[model samples]
Target: MKQTTFLLVFGVVLSFCQAQSETGGEETGGEEEHVELFTTPATKMGAATSDFGYNLFRALASRESATNIFLAPITVSAVLTQLSMGGSEQAERQLYRALRYHTLQDPQLHTTLKDLLASVKAPGKGLSTAARIYLARRLRLKQDFFSLVEQQYGVRPKALLGGNRDMKEINDWVSQETGGKVQRFLAKALPRNSAVNTVSAAYFKGKWVTRFSQSGVMENFQVDGGSPVRISMMQQDNYPVKMGADSDLSCTIAQIQMQDDISMFIFLPDDVTSNMTLLEESLTAEFVQDLSMTLLPAQVSLTLPTLKLSYSTDLLPLLNDLGLAEWLETPDLEKISGQAATLSSVNHKVVMETAPEGNQYPSATSTTSHLSYRVDRPFLYLIRDEASGALLFIGRVVNPKDLSI
Candidate 1:
């Protein structure tokens, strides 16, 4: 049996918060202080797309909380930036509609979020309403763009591209969607010498709404091994920081309140450098439940530094390391491709980070990422319910290298 390839390189690029010596400072406009969120449609139709989107977001959130690096606004902002940069108007519209539909279809998700939001301090009563409208509009625009792309390119551009002439058209479309930021990247990253036919892209960016000031100087912040690294620190005097402890590890959950009732929870491992493999291995639906029970309130001064980083990794090895072998080892990807063809392999590369901008007290983090999959061999992939472990989207990437420009 051929080895299956599925890779996921996920991590915080860089994070920084700026603050003065005091609490309650005026908001600044910069990269370090802004946070944005966006979503996309992975498949054209059916329950797969819907379920994948929801599960992806939930898994991301859960992971952040577990790692003590919860930054919801930044995560959302990063996703939106990618969509805006890489997605077509129709693709964007489809994403928006899907998110809205999900919210409506599952009222409990909304209710739970609303309850969480209600507990936070609202800067202005109308701010939540404005936030909702902003989100709605963003989703709508994305959905419309997705539809346009489908109509113009057809569902499978590779199938449409029978010859070299068709490749040019597909490339042109890819160039237009990425605003030229990624044309060359895609060209170089994708497998050129293969029987593959079609390709798709996803990009993301995000910033904080209330950015941190960069003026404070701090030294010797503890990392995993008690080695203090001098980092640019953002100080918050009074905010919500909570703590919990289990026999295996101590956990901290911090809520960075955003507009309305939405807050980002940061979960920091008590032992930052402890073999993360155990934590990753132990991650499951029940793990999330256990983490949620750990949520409580505390008041402390937050000292986070501004840092920016980016990386790309293949997800196949990582997925295999995590015990998902059937997809990579078997030849059953026909169900996903909707065709009776032998699959290639699936590989994903992602880049993301938060960086500081100015020398002043107020600063922000700007993050961006690009994820691409080149299925040169056959393998299986699935999108599942984060809460229930239910499979939503499953398919095989057999000829990713042969995909048209």
Candidate 2:
């Protein structure tokens, strides 16, 4: 069984909150001092990657309209950008165009990317990211390229010995990187013609700032208005959330606070059978940031499902659709080595588990208002790092019961 050329792993686990709890659901961010974020090379690069991620999501969602879709845009873009550093001029240009980095004004792209990675994966941020380059035992990288990659990306290239040993080695690295949450990353043997391969993995375990009043209860979730599935829906009363309505998209957008300066934004359509095409089309980095700053505070009765889902698929076709056919067909990776190399395969997998778990015990004085926000239908969501304004994960849930897609 031949395996893929590249593997992108995205695993997220929602654990307990151990931060200092707010005594009541007080209105936050209303009369606060709004400080403008200082611009940096990494932030510029992050904005570009966020745009690319939204485009990729649109392509995937258009293809699988009824299935759940989840991916780490930052991870995929980072891996591709790292690979581009090893490409020839033409190949690099092609890859940059695909990533929408042609117009980016970042001079120190790699250095800033290093900084962004460090910031997101910093201790207690609930995000861990790792990238590696695997070369066939018969091949070798240029000394300069090897040093650059090692110094910038913080990983040294390794040999891909064929068969079960190769499988174990790669999977073991993945398991170690994600603290054993992601195991057996490579399910089968490497392809007979495998050459230069890249693997990127990220593990995120977010802790909510406020704890729910109690455990989840059985509730009905409408799956595209076809049939209702009974899902364990978590509930929170008098939640201090940033929420607003978007008339253009016919959806209500809400932001739920999480620890470590992270926020989870949810977009729920007006009707069960409503089409989310408009909302998906309108997702951009700038637009999302505007929502974050502009949406008003509210105290609502919030109810959402306890999500445990995983999705895996090949992103090659999608990349081709995104205008990378020429590069994928005949990649010019002369910087890596003199020998000819081709990158025609890329695989992606994402696993996420989040529930209502925290140390902030619910108090009697948390209530503030009587607004309601119930997510009983299909919805879209994204996890963002507020400190860096980087999109960590984007996904849509059409049917929570159907775990895999």
Candidate 3:
């Protein structure tokens, strides 16, 4: 099986050192200076959450060698963060470490997360993420925890109605949140004796800045240790892109612009035999942000595969492997309720689709060199938001035919 890693990073090209104040008019030097508070310095929060996402990705990759793994890091992180609000001191500390928030020591972490999520889910971004806490029926939540979660995460906790009914309701809600892209989110009823379950999901369908030609041709894509698979491959002539190479990782990096301050970065290894361990380990929110800034613009003959992929999984095992076994197995959510409450599961799902569509149609153009950028082999790719440097969706395609269905 081919070894590949995929990552989704959001919000690139912003300075995180100085924080942005809320939008308002401030009296300065007897003059009313009005500043639009459209954005906040949530980069620190984004970095912490993305670090957690990468950590989870590495854990999953270590277990599954060739399967396609896709997840929304922000959704998972946000759910965990919200749950921690109702946890005891020990649980809170454990979650903070899992989220890499202890390293930041920022008091306004929750607020920053709220603002970041709001921006990511804002209409017209081409991507959306949401998280919710589903407590077991008859488990009474504390007033403060309920209020804070609703105010910060913007959702009310739901009671698991039990049996097949619970499944239908949750699935319907998930479908509504994802614009009907994920109709059947849950295949079975909620876990028996489950006290709390965290649900997170993301949906994306981006338009390319430079659309690919509709005339795609079936081409051979080499899968490691397996026969080459034929798939529909889209192409564009003289596509404007930001390109770079990492000699240490032995991979070529290319960033293709998209609408709504989003960019897709592809990391294609030099050869099918190239080891992606180093590249995967080196991924961090800050590192990727720097790499995005350093990539130089160039026009290239680009060929990419059309993608429509969906992934859903239980994150309890991965979280356990990450040293949260004690917390997951115990009942220390006293702040949330006086009764014994243990985490039953963490459910996550993601769906992403992209084609040759863009603001304008593809066209032929002159180029300086024969810089052909063909993704005809196993490679890792991620969708990132340039405005805030947040990772949206990340995955690797060993064989395009695997998820095309």
Candidate 4:
């Protein structure tokens, strides 16, 4: 079997940064204001996060499959990073390959994650990321490993007392962190063979600066060139949204602000102009870094669909497919504990929604409506932190009506 070569980049889970109050658009008081709050200073780590995330998404979301895939790569990467902190050299090496920790050279991986998490958890972002490892009772961890987790990732180990009861404990932790969006994470009972379980959960609630209209109208959504279905199409006419057509990726890109520091990038591919195969192959972390600069301000007669997506499960199969065989097998986690540990599971859960705030027009007084990005068909989207370029979530929405099914 050939080993999978992952094109590494780190679009951290829903974490990104730095528009210091520029202009959200023209102010109401006759000032030549812009909707941009402040200009963000880019960071290498942030770009890495996006690169890692996009690559991972393409790996999982194949066109032959359902083509509707959604996952928070940052949450998974952060959890893996936490585990790597206590893993053996071999395990660490595999993790470094998968998560691409080497991408961030200066501040280092942990420091970069700490800074990114801080931004995501800040007031009003409506995003949360958490990682935890549960050890069976009487299984003591090394003091140094515990200290490292505390100092670097700010997570503490929760005791697993019973089988079913302990699963509830993990479930409750995820539920609280995700604002009740997630419940009952672990389905099966804990195995005696495994002594450690690593889990990560992320939740983000982004309100578009220019909101979608609550009263959506029925419109045709082209599933492919052959199939077109009517769906509730959300509209925002004459909206000032960043727009562009990426000839390289063959997708119409649009950026909608969730907050000054956070925004979402939508990539809509056409039937002939876009090929998912080529698009997937070309999504590098470096490419995403230039997104902000690549897209220009345009007056959009935006037509989007009300979106509600939730995906949850273990990514072990996908990892195995990604050629992370050693990762799934028993690894010498001597640093974490004397007891042997195998990665029994690497679990993830994510949910996202784009509800309307009733056609929220930006504060801009007047501007030429030049371009448009209408999401009338299947497309891809990235929720990112604009300042730091950290990717919070990456997904492909093929059929909105059948996304969850």
Candidate 5:
């Protein structure tokens, strides 16, 4: 249960970070500025959150018979949006000012990520001291945010917002910002009358560079390790594939090239179940970087399952398993002192899709959206490092029968 909790929280954080990074290139100004106001810093948070987030994503993705799993990336975005919307221009400036300094404290969030990767079963070749230090900096930044949250909202959030009852208002603001995804998680984990406020948000969009033909779509896809569900499976033949030889663990990574150098890496577990622990152990940032460097285009057939899933998670036990027990147990108010508050707990929800839209196509084509990679069975998936093409981490939903509550 502890491990599960750690993994769940980790997944949500990682997903949120990755999704935020996807929008890095967009131009901001006008309505884009408003979204930018919300997205820009959120994207930075992605980089900040990626360290822990990707580690958890990879851990779950490496498991056997994992399928149809969804991880929420909304936590950071929700917090940021909540703060931005509920404050005055002065408050906004102060919040950003605090975040800037806070982020600087950690430098980079990927350090703990690299460390956690080292702890896994098939620990990949280790990272350089520089890389580890860089990641540590990021973790420190996250800690900084924790500190800011506490400082801004503590027992007297009114100091920041001008009243004693601002906590409920902040929570309400969060509920509206996230489209209702995070409010429940907050209500469950936080003290009902506590005046602390936080935010989390996540969004992702991916399209096959070369769209699969609906003419080739098939149904009743056997989702390898679980109950069979009718789904549209996308197939590509003779694509480039990479196979790796490691002691006790043979693995394959399938790259789905998207537009503008973006790609999704599909990691296939060598053994259906037995080697999961080894894969988890072996998964690491260095391994992913190395794997990205080694990929060569090859001719092969790719079959992908199409699915849509949304879910929420409670991550107390998960955070403890991951060595983040202090925040959960002691309520680290010091880190959040600048804001006048403390985080009781962090909760998250995620929604994901592996399907495409039908309206965009010609009327002559089938209206049903056909997406390749029907992940009906348990398998690992990752939105990863493209140039180095390293899979940050992969997630496996082995037992759809078991759900997060």
Candidate 6:
């Protein structure tokens, strides 16, 4: 994936609005914002990215896999943490664990994210993520919680009279924040009178750094059990790629540069006959970073399937299955308002599309192929923000035809 041309996106559109009585507070980006965010060192970026990446996919390990699974862990982390700003005791601990951090005392976690949020906010950065909260009329909001969200996450709660009325606003905001890459934030307006609803959406459109040739050819892709599936394969010869083999994971690991500060890593298992179970177990932020540090550039011929995929799922059940039902309980969020308001629903939608940049490869490298790396089997990919080493999206492509939502 180069510059934003080839997208491997992870987006979560989770809404956490429930029913509540009467109230007062400005409808900011998030109902949870009221104060300024604390600024901390950027050095913690690596640790923060590592923590979130590891905890996120491990949680997905228990998820249903008959279909594609795509997500942005940071979206989930931001939502849970905003809740934690008003959470206490065990409830907060649950969020802490979900975020793959020590306890709530970890300033680096939020601050590191704060910095990343700011970095992406710079002029014209294609990778973007945003969270918005819509609150039911009269619902109370905490000052500290609101301020923390506003300052750290750069979102303000947009207080609304009803969920239905707020749907359009949420959709528009989401679309604008994601550079118009995602617009359908809410299929229909939410039920009227929910206490709180938070929506987080991420969208990406990037170009390839090294353009693949115009002549696209159909190739056989090996699905699990060696079943053959044909897909349009994009090819490039003698391209500079960071390639390596992870014997322990039994997969070919390599980094595909997108542009400056962004890249996609593909983990293609040697044994295409096997399921992704082993590869799933091997994914961790540390392992990915290790590959980044150890892998060296080489002139390689790479063939990867042209990717075009989109998916959506209800995440509450998955969160519950991960043993965090207690964390979503109304009682657990007493600090938010000391009222009976629980998370309503969590929704995630992701879109990924890739193609050659149409820029002709240098004539010199067009013919030479020292090492061949063909992604002709089930494989996992990570779209990362290279500067902070934050994983933007993660998913596996089994059947290219099965990319529908």
TM-score of each: 0.42, 0.86, 0.86, 0.81, 0.52, 0.79
lDDT against the true structure, per candidate, is 0.29, 0.73, 0.75, 0.66, 0.38, 0.63
Off by over 4 Å in 6: 1-43, 103-109, 121-125, 142-148, 188-195, 225-227, 321-323, 358-367
Number of the top lDDT candidate: 3
lDDT string for model 6 (297-360, tens) is: 5566779888877665556665665557776764366666656677665666666667788334
Better of 2 and 6 by TM-score: 2
Q: What is the lDDT of residue 220 in candidate 2?
A: 94
Of the two candidates 2 and 5, the one with more favorable TM-score, higher being better, is 2
Which is the winner by lDDT between candidate 1 and candidate 2? 2
The per-prediction CA RMSD against the true structure, in angstroms, equals 16.7, 8.9, 8.6, 8.7, 15.0, 13.6
Per-prediction backbone clash count: 79, 0, 17, 28, 84, 35
TM-score of 1: 0.42
Q: What is the lDDT of residue 348 in candidate 5?
A: 48
lDDT of 1 by residue, 353-396 (tens): 23322223322224222211111122222222222222222222
Which is the better candidate, 4 or 5, if ranked by TM-score?
A: 4
Residue 360 miss distance in model 2 (angstroms): 4.1
lDDT, model 3, position 44? 67
Model 3: weakest 10-residue lDDT segment is 29-38
* Tens-digit lDDT string for candidate 4 (226-334): 5777777777656666655655555667777776577888877755222466666766554554455434465566788877777776765666655577766876778
